[model samples]
Target: MEEMAIVFSPKYYEHNTGRDHPESSRRLKTVMRELKRLNLFSATTGCQLVEPELASIENLELVHDPEYVGLVKRICELGGGLLDLGDTVVSPKSFEVARYAVGGARKAVDSVLDGNYQKAFALVRPPGHHAGPYYGAGFCVFNNVAVAAAYLIEQHSFERVLILDVDAHHGNGTQEIFYDSEKALYMSLHEDPREFPGTGFVDEVGEGAGLGYNVNVPLPFGTGDEEYMKAFDEVVVPVARQYEPQFVLVSVGYDSHYGDPVGKLQLSAAAYESIFKKTLDLASTVCQGRLVAVLEGGYNLGQLGKLAALTISRMADFSYSMKDGTPPANSNVARRARRVIEKVEKAHSAFWKLRA
Candidate 1:
């Protein structure tokens, strides 16, 4: 069995959100170049590369409304346009590319579950996590990670699926999609929602049966590796250990890196490596190493490629380090993050025990 797999498709670059858009085709191009530079294609790495097929309508309906799906297809068929109130845009081929992205995520899930790979990373584009059941938002036309989670539940009969979203922005659409579902636990570590989609408040636990299943740790601006690691150790680690999911899916977004232009968080490539190591450890202990990471957001080309390469390297039990000289967190941000963590723990305490 392969230790790592990268789900990619040339069709992903055909989405064509726009030339000036932050989520552009050039993002994947830079990532591919970096992976090649790192010699990931060498025969010794044992990393399998899989090109995925386009997702079927049946699969898309698992997370998206049929009408919304039709609208996206029709819009793309008519030569494409803006998709939502946010940054989501589409060209003539975006619908196809978006479907392929979803398919790539699903393929990753299948590969991991079938023991073909211990872990897989879907490198396709038109980043998801922002697209909800009814609308596309934040450059996401379809919720790829959510679809993969739902697929695991319905197709594979998995009971608990954990989605760890490390995007700078909260995965509002993903939280919304699975808010009422106990089958999937959605946890997001993001910059404060007052800045972006405005949803991942500490108190906004899930609605019904999923009331405690959705966890949000909203950090302050200028939050760096120290603050983030603190939050993860205090909140994420405890909650994940209790949930004990059968599968783990990460909404991998490099925008949280300090070098990224879209997000203000002070994370470096080393921070990303640390995050991946923690996640892989959790998957190994609880889920039998059934983990898959799907691309969500990252605007900067240089950091995006480096962070991703470092993550995959770590997945293969190797180390590739890059330091971006991330700044230290101030006392104010640390205080704010501590307060947020407290609020999240108090709110989720009704559902999950805060400590291991």
Candidate 2:
């Protein structure tokens, strides 16, 4: 088994959202270029680039409504249009490409579960977290990580899957999908929802059996590495340990980086590295290193690829570094982040043992 596997396909580039669009083929192109420049596929890195198969309709229906799945297919077949109101543009080939993206995510999970790799990262495009059971939005066409988690439970008969979303925007769709179930715990750390998709507030914890399973840490704008790491240490790590997930999945989004144009939070590449390393350690502690990360957001073409490559290197335990300027310290932002973390801890205290 390789140390890590990267699920990607050149075909992901065919899903054209538009040349000028933030979620364009250029993003993947840049990421691939950086991966190659770093020699990530070399044996020394113990990483292999694996192409993904198209996801079957049955697999898609595991999470999404059949009608919604068919709608996306039909829309793409009819020469592609917007999957959502405006941002989620699709082309004639987008349906297939989106399936390939989902396929890539699933492939990553399978690779880790099969013991072929300790961990895997699905570097496909057309991000998925914004899409839900019946709709796609925010440049997302399908909930790739959601489907992967559902697949692990339904197909593999595994329970207790944990999804850790570090996207700058809340994965409202992923949360909604699993909001009523205990099989999957959805935790997200993102900018305040008032600034983005307008959801994932601290009080919007899960319902029914999943009442305490949904964890959201909505930070203030200008939050940097220190605040983010503190949230991970105080809130994320404790909740995750209590859940004791059988497998871990991360919605890896780099838009929170200080360089990203789409997101408002200020996170340095080093912050992302620390987050990834912490996630890897968390998985190793709870799930024997069974983890898979799927691409969700990150629009800055110049920095997206470098961050993606850095994440892959971290997964492979390969040493690679890049500096994308630091975010200035803001004591005010740190205080706000602490408040949010405290609220989140209080909100979920009934569900998990958050404090000693």
Whole-model lDDT values for every prediction: 0.89, 0.90
Q: Tell me the TM-score of each prediction against the true structure.
A: 0.97, 0.98
Residue 217, candidate 2: C-alpha displacement in angstroms: 0.7
Among all windows of 10 consecutive residues in model 1, the one with the lowest summed lDDT is: 317-326
Clash counts for all predictions: 0, 0
**Candidate 2 structure quality by residue, lDDT tens digits, 1-356:** 24898899999989988768988889889999998988788888899988898999999999999999999989998998988766799899999999999999999999888888898899988899989999999999989999999999999988899999999999999999999999999999999889568898999888999888898999998898888888899888888888899999999999999899988889998888999888888888988999899998998988998899889878888788987778679998899998888888888888888862
Which candidate comes out best when scored by lDDT?
A: 2
What TM-score number comes out for model 1? Answer: 0.97
C-alpha RMSD (angstroms) for model 1: 1.3
Candidate 1 residue runs with Cα over 4 Å from true position: none
Q: What is candidate 2's CA lDDT for residue 180?
A: 93
Q: List the residue pairs that clash in candidate 2.
A: none
